[model samples]
Target: MTRPELKTDPKYDDYDYPTTAPEVQSGHPGHTTPEQDAQVFQLRTQLEQAGYKERLDTLCMLRFLRARKFNVDLAKQMFIDCEKWRKEFGVDDLVRNFDYKEKPQVFEYYTQYYHKTDKDGRPVYIEQLGKIDLAAMYKITTGERMLQNLVVEYEKLADPRLPACSRKSGQLLETCCTIMDLKGVGITKVSSVYGYVKQASAISQNYYPERLGKFYLINAPWGFSSVFGVVKGFLDPVTVQKIHVLGSNYQTELDKQVPKENLPKIFGGTCDCKGGCALSDEGPWQDPEWKKPPKWEQPSKTSQPTTTTTAPAPQAASNAGTQAEIKGAQQAPMGS
Candidate 1:
């Protein structure tokens, strides 16, 4: 398909797109035109003038701009709200201090993790919704703890994971490829956990915009059609377009984007790690050749933990793409 025209300047028209994967276009990182760069600059200037101290990185400003469709005003408001929420939520403190000792138990009931890279070199994040046991999960952790974990994972995703993937693939990686397995999920189970899902979705969309790369709702039951139809109403068109809703026959399509060697065996791929792919935390970020400690790592504390799962006692957590919003479907949130 011909790319839509992007206003460009002779100086910035040489922006490179990845050769190994499909070209990332206008709305994402690594593909900005002159106008987009100006927009980011304007946003940065406004934020700085407004007294915002951090999160003014060019990539981040671009993300917020893309999320708001490049509307500087709306992007500014969103950025302001996100910063306020960050402080109120104590995100910086949680990233450094919060630990989820019950991570092992939590994973047993609700599986979420980064296993490996997709064919395009973006990290593959997998979640199993059909297996959720909210009651059991809550026994070991509260909803607040889960939110903290989500924030922590988002931070890790932005750092070690994406940077490592970018270095390994020789490209700039900004989003994630998500696979949400829904084999046994039914309305009753969904209803029981809707509240938590809503809260989670809000945090992801409101705080972490533009992180979805590819989304696959695999093993989707027949009943999910109506549910998804309703869910679709709540998501943006760009996000809805990125989602692939599939039933049991998801293997063929999944294999096209994620290599069988990299995919977990349970998902119709050849991979089955020593423990389990859900908890493996395997990816380019873990490769000694490319891996580096996250900037957030503290000298005194060696191990890093995340919301979905924690690092081993002696270790730290490691760290995708799409223009998709990841809203309403990809994340465990009943809704972003």
Candidate 2:
């Protein structure tokens, strides 16, 4: 049998496809803006001078800069503060060595999980806030351990999760699709967990800027929207825009962005993976059968020092290529 001819569109004949994981692209101001590029360069130079060259990458630096709206001094201070926190929290040691043996037990009381991919191919992170029982959770794990687990998950997201999603989608995916379920939450419950929630939110927003692509507050209780209206006044407009507060009738809207098969049965879908959906970690990134080819070329060890700062380490570079290839194959037509 003869294979069909591969067709090309003239419109995209001049399109320069991304060859690297975080290569600059249109529409993503955080990655492409001239000011951001300058800031990234400046930040890297400063980090190297401060002997923190090995501690962070351009992407991490950009996150801090974006968090501070590209204010050099503010971004530097934020980076320094994060470094201090990392030492105090032992985040590096946690990432390399810490193990959460109580993950299963803790999840039973507080459902926080990365289930599957949304329509845009971003990982879907769901947190059933109403299900959280601090008393029960603390029996298995302390708040400190929970925060450590959260940090580990965030590190994994930066390494394998987003990279894998980006590879599968044939584009850079630095953010996640989030669903915060507040079905049984009341004022009393909210007050009970206010401190923990506030701390977690601070860590995510201040330290991991641009990590939230889409946020859905589903199963919103009565008066929650009005409360959010007041709370949003203190949030960045860009952050507020990504959040959608939905009532019980959120299935229709959720279905538009997430396939029924990908979503869990509890969340108005049919997926019931073995063990449980909350712990399944099911997604394209976890598919062993879908192997991604290496698409990014490794930079030479002796490349110009200026360019070297932009390139990630050898392992990271390899992972980026692997991820992009996986996403490209999964999402795009063969020989397109």
Candidate 3:
């Protein structure tokens, strides 16, 4: 029997995404191979040199192309021609005789097996595939076969841990994509609006002593706007801008109430891999040269000051006419 096919052909050309030839790039440090891997990587670079930017995964894109325009047999042959054939990498490499931590029965009792008689009532023994006692291994289980060449289509998140060990940025974005769907907002619906959401989500998933910090997109796209103006005109834009304004304004007021020496210390280092983004920008964006808040001080409260300002003393007018004006000024209410 044949395996499952990756792409589904459509009856009509409803959505024709422009055909983009994928740009393949070489693997880094660990996975690079001295064989055909080099040739595939080199070809990928050449394609980039030719000036083409259609973000496509060579293998997956081919599957999509063959979808409706081509036949299944033809697709299969094409995959074969591309040498996309895959299988489990040698199991023996996984720590010799490690019958995979799965099959327990085979290891626990070597001769033990499960059985049932055939239609003829003869004894039949089935190989005990369970009870395999493999020791603990570090690598997390991954389902997809390794591809020889792949080009990143966007600013891929940097995560060095295995999928089992921790969630990487790409994984986090995919998760956010699923979450947006749950909120009844499709990816196509908020393609651009949800990017910051994805970024915040990925950053929050980073490993820390604390349970991975929670992802909270301030002014997230939880509300809708019904505008009646030309495009790009105001109307409060999205909730994010409002939240940003509120935060900055609040911080400014908060700073006014505290001593200049008590502000939060800013942090910056070459280690920050976020491309100069302010997510980790601790000290004031204005001047890193200024001294940071000392360890003993607490962060300034975000609320407004409760103390009232003293009113200016009422002045005595030199003449009666001026006296009336002075009284009116003294009587004026705060809001007025």
Task: Write down the TM-score of every candidate.
Answer: 0.82, 0.77, 0.15
Reference-based lDDT, residue 258, model 2: 84
Local accuracy of candidate 2 as per-residue lDDT tens digits, 168-280: 77665777788877888778877777666656655564345557677788998888889778777666666667778899999999998888998999889999999999878
lDDT tens digits, residue span 1-336, model 3: 432221222321122121211112222111223542333333333333433222223333232222212233333233222222111322112222222232232223211111111121111111111221112211221111100000010011111111111111111111000000012333353453233223322222111001111111111232322211222242223211211211112334323222223222221112232322212222221132322322113332221113432332332212233222211111110000
**Rank list by lDDT:** 1, 2, 3
Candidate 1 or 2, higher TM-score? 1
In candidate 3, stretches whose alpha carbon ends up further than 4 angstroms from where it belongs are 1-175, 178-336
What Cα-based lDDT does every candidate model obtain?
0.73, 0.63, 0.21
**Where does candidate 1 stray beyond 4 Å?**
1-24, 226-234, 298-329, 333-336
lDDT of candidate model 1 versus the reference:
0.73
Candidate 1 per-residue C-alpha lDDT over 179-205 given as tens digits, one digit per residue, 9 for 90 to 100 = 998888988987887777777766777
Least accurate 10 contiguous residues by lDDT in model 2: 327-336
Model 1 TM-score is 0.82
Worst 10 residues of 1 by lDDT: 314-323
Q: What total of clashing residue pairs does each candidate reach?
A: 13, 5, 11
